[model samples]
Target: MGNAEIIAGIKIPDSQMAKAVTELVRDTETDLLYNHSRRVFLFGAITGERKRLKYDPELLYVGTMFHDMGLFDSYASETERFEVDGANTARNFLKSYDIPERDVDDVWDSIALHTTPGIPQHKRPTVALVTAGVEMDVLGIAYHDFSDKEREEVCACHPRGLRFKHAILSAFCYGTIRKPGSTFGNVKADVLERMDPTYKRENFTEIIMGSAWDS
Candidate 1:
């Protein structure tokens, strides 16, 4: 049987999967991975909000977090094809949520295609929204500074700062890509206007990236 089939056979309810996700996120000690997921959520949510995409913020948030849940799956360690395993695991877990077919597909596709570069570019607004979210997620993984254990420990206690860091990190990571027809051009502007209401984009980028630990 496929991993997805096995996961589907598990009796965990949607509510319980949600609880499991929440607890996993809460206890995750890997700051880098946690922050990367947070940025993907913020980026996806903001893009969806600005474009009026039909995706529910709560759904996007959960999917992004659990999109990578399979990394911890036994499959990731056993098989070389972790992305496929991750996608299957996500689809199975989401099915427990009774999530719509379309949204489930979206989340699955995002997880599946995130690491593979050079796929044919998509042009749909919703596709673009997800693509940008996933791209920013990769950028965060490739570039973010997660070395300041003290800051991460401190920010963990300050949920507000953590939230701000999440948003800012998303902006810093994916804010520069002007993908064809991308709405990100205005995204940074919106976040800055909404988050700071005063600073220019250059200042925002400089300040946030400067303060983030690079090593």
Candidate 2:
């Protein structure tokens, strides 16, 4: 059997795979988005376990971890395209990394249709399960405080912390949850450009006020 086949048949070591993906995403200049993506992967894995998906847990984890790998390309390009290009990027990267075809398609489909919203109704059950978890992750991004046990709205590791607040603020500011065909590139550069280190905490509100990322 090939390397990809070996990876597919066994459980992937989380730290090892996560390190590689983290490096790849960090280099792409989407560190915070990458962090959130990792959380989505974790959430997806747990949801898959709970839902009894027949697929390998490792496959679900790895696939979801790299779902937004193409976000970098989308960010760099001028067209704001994501689905098709993101899938192509995933295909190429997985092929280069020797990922198995079935597992590859699993990730590709999930990434391609992630922002499509309505596409979930027709997706594979596992995809739908993962999607819901990812959505919750997005929803919990900036607003949910994990500390208040009695609140009962959302849950996360460090709710109400800086990371939690940043994510929540990001989701409210950068989230594109239900809208379809919303490309990050199509967004005005002035918006995301302001998200740079120079921007103040309150600047997110101004920058994202009328942007598609807020959709």
Candidate 3:
């Protein structure tokens, strides 16, 4: 494997494992998601560099690439949060390659917590960067941190299609719509709320009041 594609000064890892995961994701996910995952890796790596963080690029690459696996039908689980589905899928794949448990755990955490806000940023570098990359690409959080050239370069390579905002939201809705309970407290609840008018958000206050424990 050759380091053939470099975006924003970060070289795409060419390790055998890297190539394997890349091939898996590209084959399994739609172009919208495949390209988004690649952009996540590039943006994550760039952020890691800017922060002067000491991290393994290969591990981060794997994490970013697999972070959205749960959103696809092949990996989606009936009774789990989409994030957990993705984490478990990545865990299984890495364990197959006999990756060390510690590294495997990091990748698991990265995918599981990418949609979570506040917490991941405090975890390991790989974990934090996964969420950072997602936020940057999806919500445009910290959009100004990257230079115009960097943004253009990454998008030029991955090309966040003409209607990325709506398309991604649709993807999210499609993935989790069947398992609405899984979105109880997470951000996907918002996706369901927007896409499904019939979606009834689980109200925290109502749950507490309905609980058997009486004050």
Worst 10 residues of 3 by lDDT: 1-10
Ranking the candidates on TM-score from highest down gives 3, 2, 1
Q: For this target, which candidate reaches the highest lDDT against the unseen true structure?
A: 3
The sequence of per-residue lDDT tens digits that candidate 3 reaches over residues 100-213 is 899899999999989889999999998989988999999998899999999999999999989999999999999999999999989999999999998999999999999999
Task: Please name the candidate that would achieve the greatest TM-score relative to the true structure.
Answer: 3
Q: Write the per-residue lDDT of candidate 2 for residues 27-132, one digit (tens) a residue.
A: 7635555556555655555455545666555545545565555445443233334454556665666665666677677777776676556675367654564465
The clash count of every prediction, one per candidate, is 0, 5, 0
How many Å off is the CA of 167 in candidate 2? 5.6
Under the 3 Å rule for N, CA and C atoms, how many clashes does model 2 have? 5
Ranking by lDDT: 3, 2, 1
Stretches of candidate 1 above 4 Å error? 1-19, 27-29, 73-77, 117-128, 140-215
| Residue pairs in clash, model 1 | none
Stretches of candidate 3 exceeding 4 Å from the true structure: 1-3
Score candidate 2 by lDDT. Answer: 0.50
